[model samples]
Target chain A: MKTRLMVLAISLASFSGVAMGFDFGKLLEDRLNQELNKDKKTQPATTPPPAGSQSAAASPPATKQKVDAGQLGFALFGDYSPEEENRIGKQISGNLLGAVPLVRDDGLQRYVNLVGNWVALQAGRKNTTWHFGVLDTEDINAFAAPGGYIFLTKGLYRRLNNEAELAGVLGHEIAHVTQRHHLKVLKKSSLIGALGQAASSKAQGSDQMVQNLIGNGAEIMARGLDKDAEFEADRVGIVFAARAGYDVWGLPTVLQDMAALPAKDNRTSLLYKTHPHPADRLAALGEAVDGRLDGIQGKELANRFYKIR
Target chain B: MKKFLIPVSAFLLCVSAASAWASPGTVLRNEQLFSQPTSGSRVEANVAKGASVNILSKQGGWLRVTAGRSTGWIRLLSVRAGAGGSGGSGVGDVFGAATTRSDPSRVVAVAGLRGLNDEDLKQAKFNAGELARLEAGTVTTSQAQSFAKQSGLASVNVPGLPEPRPAQPSSSWENN
Candidate 1:
């Protein structure tokens, strides 16, 4: 009996180490108990929930991971000279626009685009032109493709409260484009070579989409970006958003929402996969906005361009 | 009257020749050039190579050159003469010191294995030697990770950390 208990302890300890940021130990124990109860001898109907399981309500899994869309975008922007970054942006813009049927809620797209333009102008990328688009999908995702192309998912759009939030998100995305962080990451991963290889292929349509999704996602999350990159993006994003007349609090608030999300809180999912923790990001954003914009409050210019219920 | 005019013309020619001779070698040097004279400032504007400068005087290892529109002095050693016989002095400018920082590119082949975060697991390539090289200071940390990812080991566990047993073992391994 003592040896069995020891085995359980070691298993739990090992499970905890492997499951960092996840509550898999209790789940594992419950499964073990279930197996034991199925024996020919006397079997307990149900096992007690593990001790840590009680706090499950407080912290659900990783559905709420903070995704550094900026890093994702920057990973696409290689460390080309400012001139090269601009040229690549133009090429990517032409290629992606030709490929994807971008979301065109005229009002929303224009509003987001205007905000994006304003933020981009303030962020000051002298060489590249910035373009923003809305995707028709309901998934809660926003992507900044290489070469200054940004796509906002309808799911993310429907969840936003106002222009400030949109501007805040746009600012983050713009920062990614300006910083060319995606390309820096790609260079880190050596995917820039793969891009040259990809270029040689004649693949188009769904094939390109598959290549893009797989290539792009692998490029960004592969080997996991350093935590510093996400932190810097948030810092720069807040400033750009604030300069573009969006309330500085929008970023923090968005982060709060993300932290409160249920289902995606795995450590790897939260940090290496998506980005830094939303809580950490929120805290960083708060510190950045504080005292920086003294007496500067932004007003939202709402119109037919966008409406929030 | 002819003799008088001839003497006067000769005198004028002599004066002109002397002035021309004086201008060519009038190079300034060091403290003598910077000493309180024409312009009243401790420092002069940045001087470029092959710039034209008028030498006011040549002192011990220094030259008082007319820098830009204003005249100031610079070390004669610091100034180089223009390509021609023109008595021009060189100007020296100050720049901030450059510092050496680590490069991420060098560590592309030997990165150490750490457990993968979900993001890292997605990668299909990685190079361990590059990561090890980085840890060994042979490459940069960023480069090491990059190589590890490229070599398809992005999600492999970091070597330094305690590892769990593999889910399955071969019969020879199990015997041990």
Candidate 2:
């Protein structure tokens, strides 16, 4: 029975990879077409619109419109190119991690890595190399950096009751990466160049001070966005999680719990400042999760991580 | 038949004395008690489960006792005289609506917040991310509840507690 269950789990994991929403193969093909178009524009209109670029006008009777990384270009730093977002996302992720002390427990690291690798296999973004790290701080926080880097705080470890919730967190961050929210923000704001310059300078600081700054930066990023952007991530996050076979209810339940925490007199703490008010997020999620994935739970994954402390 | 009857006849039907917490003396029987209040209207409901009542002041059998949350009244036998603490161990009870896996790759994602530590900051972060992903309409709330039943956390009384007084005529007890 155990072997059968393990086989089932393995099958589900692989199936999840194949089912990811964003088709990497198609996304890459679209990117190549965009490059050809640019070359044609440069060459007095003589360079053919590449082999696949012409038939892929996106307005075909049968073919779907092409969508490239740059087509998500509006999220670039005003730079209309695929390379720009990749470079920018990598740099931002690197600089951000350099400033924070990632959590460093062997057991947790292995666990996070194993789970993360499993999730990544499900994610199926071959172009993006996923790196998972745990931060040692007591702050209850985790965030996805561009370029597929996800970080978790030690404080997060102390209070978790099970693994499903962990999956929820990872899946949501995965959504952010897959949706190219970081790039979207860069494209929306002109921060990519400025951020790149900072990266080039090799900015250095103490963990405490750096954390404070990064925390503030996270708040700024969260606050400066369109509400729709966040909504998009939440929606996709559920898809990622549901497809992976974890209990989906944990998503909203946690939000409700957080929102229900007795409101503190002062909300100036860095954590609150950076994250969305749990209440608002909960309401948003409630609407988002209305009536989807009903009757999907099976006894297996629902009871999978019940041994949580 | 004689062999069967010999040892069987030696068995005695013994009755245990009730009111284990009374004053310095008597062994009381047929004891009954009501719950008391510790505080608020939302007092933990476990107190009324077989608790002893002092009848300090009662509109009825609803005497007050120190429920974890507050004081409240319970019928005389709502709580048994000898019963101590809530019926179950504080934690380890499972709670939440069950949901099936939507995608196998996204196990952690679909797992959503079920197993995340409530008090952890990482949980908060993951929660936010999950919130965003759920916007896509794939997540389900199916079920969510704490593992603890009568633990340090909040408690709700089983409704119509102690089973509504059994409907029977007073003469029946006298005949017994």
Candidate 3:
């Protein structure tokens, strides 16, 4: 089981090099055979340890090998193209919307897009178009998908006192996309995650191939990326907000508010599940920031902050 | 060990116990507190790591704090506002989410609202209309630029932060 996982990790890590010169197919074939030989004696394949993850390594190789012999290696090891990333993001976002639709207020949605786009403009990913949504749910959390889909719950939005804080929050989510954090998590499961687009509505815009890559529903969002990924987003996020000329303290202040909330707040249930404690995040951010941001004189624009009814 | 971060603004009060003159904080590192918020100012006191200080006020990236009898300004990041201190150890975490990871069945619904769960996301089906609405709301870069300009939110040239050094639990605040 360990050897099988190591093969997957190594291939995933070295994927970028395949286009440069490495014979990825041969490497994946060799590694697959080795993994198969090692796991040959082991009973059915072990599931991915991180519960709720839908990944190829978790599937028994015996069944996968027999069902589709040729495509297995590339399907499991190849990196996603930009187009593929967008489609995957769209499917995930569509499903997420089905679960909880976007906030009905057009003004709020437009305002978020404006703020999100402003923050993302500094993110350095010019080729990708971004989509920002304010989900109506009272859940106090934000989410990012592979492409450029970013969502923050209305509950979280209500907590902000200014556009800078909103920018800070948006900055964190934008960082997730710029850093390709969701894609990193999706890459693992992309192999087995494709439970087919069977459950999806045969709607006008849905892509079957992307559906197969994401697994059932939008479970990937629920599964979440690891803690390290979340911390990385926080680090990248504050910078994005600051680079856009907003107060860098926006994100940290939001963390302080979260830290002060009662332990039983249901709004934060999903957030704490996928992220480190707010206090821990603050400490981590403190390490990366310390004196580095002192020179910046950014805006906290408390007056321009839009109030929600 | 109660924290008191009384911000000048009423909305800035994060905790109900914040009725005092100043907020409490934990010093992340053993650093000098300057007489002014700037590092070029005269050093007033050298505070040790893990020491408690009262955060009197804040400037851009500095906080005016009083440590013991000595009072001076330190880098804002140098102090975390709370009695829980670094990592909020033993402090009320304000969320029961992490525990649910170990046992999804252990979810406690204290907030009355039926919060989002893994099952809902897992069982969700696509809604193309909503996705269309989301995309329709996308603002063009130029549009976003104008919107920012309206609020005087111009783009700036801030350097990216360096990843924390020492890969294993890098923050010094956590060491203590």
Candidate 4:
């Protein structure tokens, strides 16, 4: 009777162990599925949303997540976070302010912000804190830093014919921010790699390395992005402007105006150096605007622009 | 001087006329042409996919096009920018023609500018105070919306167009 009782007890213990093992396996599988679903939801942050579903409220949380993860990793490496881009943008923007003076016109600043923010809201990543500033310089130029900071020179501002024209230029700069053009250039230049190293290493030299990266980034911004990026900005800029109810021709008109200027003018010198030739830009924009945008009748708002100016 | 002025005026007229002429484009998708640029306007016609139209004018996000004598507005995103049924040569031809005008002297002059150059960037000091001030100037999204409403800028639902591929090799500015 004692031997039979012992055998029953051993069998019961083995049965309980197998049941526990099966439960553990199920738990692992469930957890993995949950993680995979979470990843799938978050991965489309960079891709554009489908048409007719572009409402700002309808945008996925992945965009917000991507922006918040700026400190994490290369966005291309599945870790490039917008928060990281914002941090880098802030640092570079600070350096830029040191290089140029800001235009302190309250009304003008507000006008630019209204226009810029309106257009930026139309973008896929609409949550960025888009800031627009007018630099108090006569250089006919505009610059975009990552993280939605855009600057336009007073010269460029004064040259614009109307609000639609202004929107076109701002839209172009905004495209750079939306597309993260400067950030891509920085990434390709080993600046981001150095930054990664700086973040990982606790050495004293890491600070210097980071500073160097910023320096290089500032240099690239001043030098201008690669031509592909500039053209893309022009293309995307018009779309954004058009999307925001501005005349789509605003960018092309501005490009034509720029092209008509002599190549040797100092006002255009910096702009010319940093951008594709106005003619090339014009032709490219011409192609973009010719048929696709021709039928779109957007608000020119010339009188309102004049009032603001 | 009079002779020169005449030739210049004629050349300018030619340029203007060339620019003013609208290029023909084909519809990439079945879309409705509205009487006005807005979507709420009366639908003038249903433009089928692959339809040909002479793109005449633009009103915000809509295009005024002529498709088979029925002139009306179509969404700008519904049409590709060239005449060919397939992707056309507009971008390629324009870029090819533009590459020949590169002037080396103008490039050198641009390199000599003072602020925001490579050396200036290298020597740039970070100004956190200025950055903070700039950030403070930002308008909230609500403020922007109110401003848009005040400005009569209605939020139109223009379909997002596909990103155009880089039509040219990186221009001369890349080497700088």
User: What does the interface RMSD come to for each candidate?
Assistant: 27.1, 20.9, 4.7, 9.4
Give the residue spans of candidate 3 off by over 4 A: A1-75, A195-204, B1-24, B88-110, B169-176
**Best model number under TM-score:** 3
Q: What local lDDT score does residue A242 receive in model 2, on the 0 to 100 scale? A: 52
Ranking by TM-score: 3, 4, 2, 1
Instruction: Name model 1 segments beyond 4 Å from true.
Output: A1-79, A86-101, A195-201, A204-225, A264-272, A302-305, B1-176
Considering only chain A, what is the TM-score of each predicted structure?
0.59, 0.60, 0.77, 0.69
**Model 1, B96: alpha-carbon shift in Å?**
52
Worst 10-residue lDDT window, candidate 3 chain B: B1-10
Better of 1 and 3 by TM-score: 3
Q: Could you give candidate 4's fraction of true interface contacts?
A: 0.36
* Local accuracy by lDDT, each model: 0.43, 0.37, 0.72, 0.62
Residue A149 lDDT in candidate 2: 63
lDDT of 2 by residue, A1-309 (tens): 323322322232223234332243334334435443654422222221222322212222111224232222122112223333343443444443434444434545555654454444445566555656666555555667556667666655554555556666776677677767665444333311212111113133221111211222233233333444455565666555555555554444344334323222122123344455443454355444433344345111333332312
Candidate number achieving the greatest lDDT relative to the actual structure = 3
Q: Model 3 chain A — which ten-residue stretch has the worst lDDT? A: A46-55
Q: Estimated TM-score per prediction?
A: 0.41, 0.43, 0.75, 0.59
CA error at residue A212 for candidate 3, angstroms: 2.8
